[model samples]
Target: MTEQISVLEKKIEEVTKRISDLKDIDSIRNLHHTYGYYFDACLFNEVVDLYAEDSEVRFMGGIFKGKESVRRFFCDRLRMRHSNGHNGPIYGFLLDHIMMQDVITISEDGKTARGRYRTFMQAGRHELAEGLTRQWWEGGVYENTYVNEDGLWKFKILDYRGLWHADFNTGWAHTPPNLYPFFSDTYPNDPIGPDEILDIVPKPVLWPDTGVLPFHYPHPVTGDEWDQNKDLNTSK
Candidate 1:
C-alpha cells in the first residue's frame, strides 16, 4: 500500500507540471493576439511595453534592440510615416492585422518559449508628409521568441518577414513589393542595413503564391518516437 501511494504522488506531480506547461503555451498565444490588438489600435505605448528591456525587434529589414530602440522604431519612424487609423468612413483607412497559425513550444523548464505566427494584413495609410493615401495588401510571417521574465512573458526577439507588400488596386503581379521598405529621414538612431535577410519566396510574393515560413517544431511522429528533450536556447 505504501509503495502504491508513493507512485501515485509522483504521477500526480508529473501531471501537474504538464498542465502548467500547457497553460503557459495558451498564455503565449493570447499574448501574441493581444499585441496585434494594441498595434492595430495605434496604442504605441502599450505595444512597446510588451517587449523585454533588452529585446530585439526586426521589421521592414530593420533590427531594433532594447526597449528604447523598439519604442523609437515603432513610435518615431513607423508611426510617423503612415497614420494608419482604422477610421472607416471619415479617412477610409484600414488597418486589420490578424495573426494566426501559431505553433508555440514551451521549454520543459518553463523559462522560455518560441512561436511562429502568420499575419494576414490589409492596411491602408494616409500620410501628411507623402501628401497621398495608398492602400496595400501585405502578409508576413513572424518567427518570435519570448521569455518568462519576473513571471510575465515578454518578447525577446520579434523577427517579421514581409512576404508581400503590394497595391490593392493593381495586384502583386504588376506592383510587386513595389516600394522599397521606407524609413523616416529624421530617424536619429543607428541604422541596421538589410545586409542579409531570410530567403523569402521570389522577390515579392504575389497573390495566390504564399511565402513559406519555416517550422520551429519537429515533425509529428507516431507511436512515441520522439525524445522529450528540452534543449531550447536561454531566453536572454
Candidate 2:
C-alpha cells in the first residue's frame, strides 16, 4: 500500500512540472503576440515596455543594444517616420504585422526561453497621407529570447531578419534587390541609427533573391540543422 502511494506522488509531481512548462510556453506566446498588436498600432512606448531593461534588438544588420537604445530605434526613429511621432495609428498609414508560427522552448529551470516566429507585414501610405502613397508586402523571421522577470516574461533579445520585400503591384518575382537598405551608419552620428553595425556574412538580400534566414533550433524529430544551400537562389 505504501509503495503505491509513493508511485502516485511521483506521478503527481511529474504532471505538475509538465503543467508549469506548458503555462510558461503560453505566457511567452501571449507576450510576443501582444507586442505585435502594440507595434501594429504604432504604440512605440508600449512596445519598449515589453522588453527587459537590459534587452537588445537586432534589425536590418543594426544592433540596438540595451533598452534605451531600443527605445531610440522604435520610439524616436520609427515613430517619427511612420506615425509622425504619434502614439496610435494615423489616418493614411497602414502597418500591420501579423506574427505567427511560434516554436517556443522553455529552459529546465523555467527562467529563460527561446522562440522563432514568422511575421507577414503589409505597410504603406494611403492617398490621404502627405507622403508618397505606396504599399508593400514584407516577410521576416524573429529568432528571439525571453526572460522571466519575477512572474512575467519579457523580451531579452529581439533578432528580426527581414528576408524579402516587394511592391504590392510588382510582387516578389519582379522585386528589385536592396529594396530596403540596411543601416550603414551608427547612432549619435545618425541621431536615429543603431548602436552597432553588424558585418553579416553572405549578406542578406531581398526578393527576387531568395535567401533563407537561418533557423534558431534544429529539426524537432531529426535533430539536424537546416541546410543553408538547399534550393535558395538569387535574382539575375
Candidate 3:
C-alpha cells in the first residue's frame, strides 16, 4: 500500500508540472499577440500596461526604459508620424503578424522567462497623399524577456532586429491637381515627376524623436552622463 501511494504522488507531480508548463507557454504567446494588437491599434496606454513598470525596451537601433518611456516612444515618436497629413490618411488599416518560435525558459521560480519570435507587418493605405494609395511591409525577429511580479507577467525587454523592409508603391499614379497644392514647393516628387495619373498628396513623416530615458543612451541630450549603474539592471 505504501508503494502504491508513492506512485500516485508521483503521477500528481507530473500532472502539476505539465499544467505549469502549459500556462507559461500561453502567457508567452499572449504577450506576443498583445504587442501586435497595441501597436497596430496605436494604443499607447495599453502597450504600456503590458510591460513591467521598470521594464526596458530596445528596438529599431535604440533603447528605452520604464513603462513611461516605452509609452512615449510608441505614442510620441512612432505614432506621431500619423498626426501630419503629408504621409497618408490616418484612417487606413494595418495588419501585424507575429510568429512565436520557442520559449527558451519558463523559470520555475516564476520570476523570469524568455522567448523568441518572428514578426511581419503590413500597412495598407486607402487614401494617402491625395489619390496615391499603397502598402508597406516590415518584418523582424523579437527576443523577449518577461518577469513575474505580484502574480502577473510583465515584459522586461523586447529586442527587435529587422530582417527586411520594402514598400509596394511604385509611384505609378500621377499627382492629382487638388492634391498638388498640399505638397511643399520643394517636394521630392516635384522634381522626380510621376508615371501614371493619380491624385498627388504630401508625404508624412513616419519616424519622430521620442524623449530619451536614463540608461537608454550613454549620454543624455544635455551632454551629461546617464546613470552608469542602471545598465546592470537591463536585460542586455
RMSD to true structure for each model, in Å: 7.5, 2.1, 15.1
Clashes in model 1: which pairs? none
Model 3 residue 73 lDDT score: 59
Model 2: per-residue lDDT, tens digit, 1-236? Answer: 99999999999998998999999999999999999999999999999999999999998888999999999989999999999999989899999989989999888888999999999999999988977889999999999999999999999999998888888997888777777788899989989899999876566666666566678788989999988766666656
Model 3 deviation from native, Cα RMSD in Å: 15.1
lDDT of 3 by residue, 20-116 (tens): 8778778778876777777666665567778888886665444566676676555655555542322222465454555655445677765788777
| Residue 84 Cα positional deviation in candidate 2, in Å, after optimal superposition | 0.6
Rank candidates, TM-score, best first. Answer: 2, 1, 3
- Which of the two, 2 or 3, has more TM-score? 2
Clashes of 1: 0
For each candidate, give its TM-score against the true structure: 0.74, 0.91, 0.61
Could you tell me the C-alpha RMSD of candidate 2 in Å? 2.1
Prediction 2 TM-score vs. true: 0.91
In candidate 2, how many Å is residue 99 off? 1.4
TM-score of 3: 0.61
